[model samples]
Target: MPTIWLFAIVLVTGLAGFALARGRAVASAGGDTRVMHSRPLYHGLNGLLTAMLPALGLLVAWLILQPVLLDRAVVGAIPPEVLEDGAARSLVMADVRRVADGLDAAIAAGVATPEGLAALTAEDDVRGLLGQAGVALGSDVSPYVLEAARDMRATAATLRVVMWVAVLAVLAIGLGVALKRSHADYRARNFVERGVLVLLVAAASIAVLTTVGIVASMLFETVNFFSQYPASSFFFSTNWDPSFSGRGGGSELGIVPLLWGTLYISFIALLVAVPVGLLAAIYLSEFASKRMRSVAKPVIEVLAGIPTIVYGLFALITVGPLLRDAIASPLGLGNSASSVMTAGLVMGIMLIPFVSSLSDDIINAVPQAMRDGSFGLGATHAETIRQVILPAALPGIVGAVLLAASRAIGETMIVVLGAGAAAKLSLNPFEAMTTVTVKIVSQLTGDTDFASPETLVAFALGLTLFVITLGLNVLALYIVRTYREQYE
Candidate 1:
């Protein structure tokens, strides 16, 4: 049977066990709700948990292990001469899996009978037979590989049967045991609660585990990249060229220009976002009337909901050309439509909602008493805001700006469409440049070998970006904590 069918059967069995167990518990309580220790729903949930959890756990383990065992067995059957290296063995295994799938497809399509499939031999025209069934093989089947594939099919079929029987048997046993325990005095509520707590804990742990997995994966590939390419050259050199060939001597895999562009663009973005967003927040929170605040807040936040790619397109089609003709050409600056200024300006607009929303919340979080106290001291509204309110909310405002900075730094689409793909360290905002994220995309695009330094350098760039963001977050936290402690 297919795995999906098996899963459906198991689910249905659990649901049935839930109803049966609930009915049995009610009957045991003489159909009197006051007699039982827990509700009928709790009893039903206990039965469901008992029936599904262990059986499903076993099913998952079997699914994971069965493939490894099957691959080992089939690979073992291949002759040593045919298994020359990892790549060659992988190729042979690919053929084995393809032939195995082709046989099943041929039988199902009615182009080959079961008996005909059984009679397939290595010396026979296996490729021709498969092709007739609309399954093309890259090469003719060898005797060793053909025999291994036949063995793999037989093994997989037997394992499927075994898996079905084992899962069903466990489900039956668990359901029967839970049903037997479904008495008026049983602690079904406690059992269900414990199961729920375990599930919640597992859900929470997944985030931490996923973060660990990402870091470990990047670190491993980055180490491999550094082993092949010099770390000093990658970090210090100004050039940013990547030769696609795996033979790594020709490529100038420098990260300086990319890093410079990233920081330069992010700096420009923050220059635009921080002031406009902060002023908007201040006006809305302290100065605007209630109706104006309500209307303006959502209107400003709507910018956040619009997708980043739309912002990228806006930068490319509308903003880039306007900047080049109206500002750059008149000012005797560079005339490229795609330049650092175009992307930064567009990215800043994209970041405005993030800064405004977060800063609005943080500014409002300041106690109204501070403002009242400042006003009682005969201070003007602007003076009260500048002296009392901003100082009180400085830490949170810093955090909001830092978050917006990180968003600007990590932005990809805006930089790609607005900033041209020319990695350079330049002072002029109208000059074309690219960021680390753009280069990472460029390096990893197309048919790539993970073993090559050119491809693996993407991971190194990613790790570096991760570190920079981490440092920014840490610095923000330190500043916030230190500032807040002064008031506390």
Candidate 2:
């Protein structure tokens, strides 16, 4: 059976078990209002958990493991010479999966029964037959590979049958146990709560686990990159250049220029976003009428809903040109339309709502009594806001700003379109420059050789970006924790 079908069966069984267990528990208490150890709802939930968790867990494991096991078995059956001399292993495995799927298609289309399909030789127009059944191979299938596909299909079919049996058996056993444990003194509520707590903890840990996994994968590939390229050249050199596969190997691959561009653009973005967003937030929270707040706040936040690509286009077609003509050119700076200022301004515009909306909510969340206390001390409105309200909201405002800074730092589309892909260490914001992210994309683009430092360098760049963002978050956390006030 298909996985979805198995899920439906499990769900239906669990629901049925719930009803049965709820009825059983009620009957055991003689339908008394207070005699049972737990409510009918808790008893039913206990039954549902019992029938679902073990069966679903097993099904999940089976789904993950079966493909891996089958692939290993089929790969072991293939001759090593084919992978060594013929083609890449990934291509060969892909062919194996495609052919297996073709055989199943042939069976479905009545080109051959499963028995006849197994008995057929690879020499007997296998490709044409599979084609007739709507699976086209790039080339002729070898006898061993054809046989391996057949074995894979056969083994997968058997495993599906086994998974079906095992999942159902577990479900049945669980329901039976729940039925047996449905007495008044069974403590069904406690069992149910414990199971719920375990599930909640698992859900909560997923983010941490995912972060660790991401860091580990990048670190491994980064280690691979560093093995081929010197760490000193990558970190200390000011250049950012990578040689093509045919151009021979003396690529500079320096990170300094890219890091400078990244920080420079981010600094400009923060400069634009922070004061504007914070002031807008303050106005909305402190000065706006209720009607204006409802309308204007959403209007301001609409910038957040606008796509970054759209902002990139705006930077390219509008903002970039405007800045070059109005400011850069008139000031005797470089007249390039695509410049650090162009991207930074556009990115800052994109990030405004991120800061403004968050800061607005945080400022509004400050206790009303704080403002009243300031007023009672004979402080003016502006003075009270500066001294009392802002300080009280400082931690949350810091968090909001940090969020905006992170967004600015990671921006890609605006940087790409507004700031031309010129990696350079320049003091002029009017000069075009590219960031680490843009280079990461460029290095990994097209048919890249994984063994080459050029491709592996993307992972290193990514790891560096991750570390930078992590440090920012840590710094923000330290600032917030250190300065946060305790309110009664």
Candidate 3:
């Protein structure tokens, strides 16, 4: 049976077990609710959990293990000549799988008989027959590959049948045991509660596991990159050229220019975002009327809801050209539409909502009594805000700014569309420059060779970006904690 059909059967059985167990519990209590240790609902949930959990666990394990075991068995069956190296073995295995799938398709379409397929040989034009049945092959089928493919198909079929039988047997056994234990004095509520707590812990562990997986994968690839390329050249050199083919020893893979562009663009973005967003937040939280606040806050937040790609397009067609003509060219800075200024300006506009919304809430969280006390001490409104409200909210405001800075640094779309793909360490904002993210995308695009430094360097770049962002977060936390303690 199909996996989905098996899942449906298990689910239906569990649901049926729930109803049966609930009825049994009520009957054991003599239809008196107060006589039972737990509610009917808890008893029902206990039965459902018992019927489903073991069966689902077995099914998942079987699915993960089956392919691996079958692949090993098939690989053993193949001739030693075909298993030359890792890449060669992988390619041959791919062909074996494709041929197996094609044979299955041909049989399903009635274009090939089972007996004919069993009797097939390499000399019998197997690829032509498969092609006639709409299964194309890149090369002629060899005898060894054909044998391996046949073995793989047969093993997979057998394992699938075994999986279904085992899962069903477990489900039946669990349901019987759960129903037998459903008595008036049974601790069904405690069992169900413990199971729920286990599930919650498992859910939380997934996030931690995901972070570990990301770090491990990047670290492995970065180690490979550094093994082939010198660490000193990658870190300290100012050049940024990468040879697509891993042929040249002269390919400069330095990250200095990329890092400079990233920081420079982020700095410009913050220069525009911090003042505007902070001022807007102060006005909205402190001065705006209720009617205006409601309307204006939502309007400003709508910018955050707008997609980054839309902002990229705005930067490309509108903002980039506008800056080049109106500001950069007139001031004799540069004539390029795609420049650091264009991307930074558009990215800043995109970050405004992050700063304003967070700062507004942080400012509003300050106690009203603090402001009142300041006013009674003969301080003016402006003095009261600067000395009392902003000071109290300074930690949160700094955190908001740091968060915006992180967003700016990680931005890709605006940098790609607005800033041209030229990794440069120039100081002029009007000059075209690209960040590490843009180079990462460029290096990884198209038919990439994973073993090449050109491709592997993307992982190194990713790890660097991760470290930079992590340091920023740590700094933000430390600052927030220090100031928060003083206020408390």
The model with the greatest TM-score is 3
Q: Residue pairs in steric clash, candidate 1? A: none
Q: Whole-model lDDT for model 1 versus the true structure?
A: 0.90
RMSD of 1: 3.4
Taking all chains together, the TM-score of candidate 3 against the true structure is 0.88
Among all windows of 10 consecutive residues in model 2, the one with the lowest summed lDDT is: 82-91
Stretches > 4 Å off in candidate 2? 31-34, 78-154, 243-252, 329-332, 376-378, 443-452, 485-488
lDDT of candidate 3 over 372-409, digit per residue (tens): 99999999989988989998999989989999998998
- Provide backbone clash counts, one per model: 0, 0, 0
lDDT by residue (tens digit), candidate 1, 1-488: 68999899889989988998899999999999689999999999989999988889899999989988788879877988768754357668878988988888888888888787778888999998889889998778988888888888889998999999999999999999889999889999999999999999989999999999999999998998998899999999999888875458489989999999999999999999999999999999988999999899999999999998999999999999999999999999988899999999999998898888888898899988888999999999999989888888989898889889889888899999999899988899999999999888888887666667788899999999999999998999898898887667
The TM-scores of all predictions, comma-separated, are 0.87, 0.86, 0.88
**Candidate 2 local lDDT, 187-268, one digit each (tens):** 9999999999999999999999999999999999999788878999999999987887542288899999999999999999
Off by over 4 Å in 3: 64-67, 77-154, 246-250
Q: Which 10-residue window of candidate 3 scores lowest in summed lDDT? A: 242-251
Which of the two, 2 or 3, has more lDDT?
Answer: 3
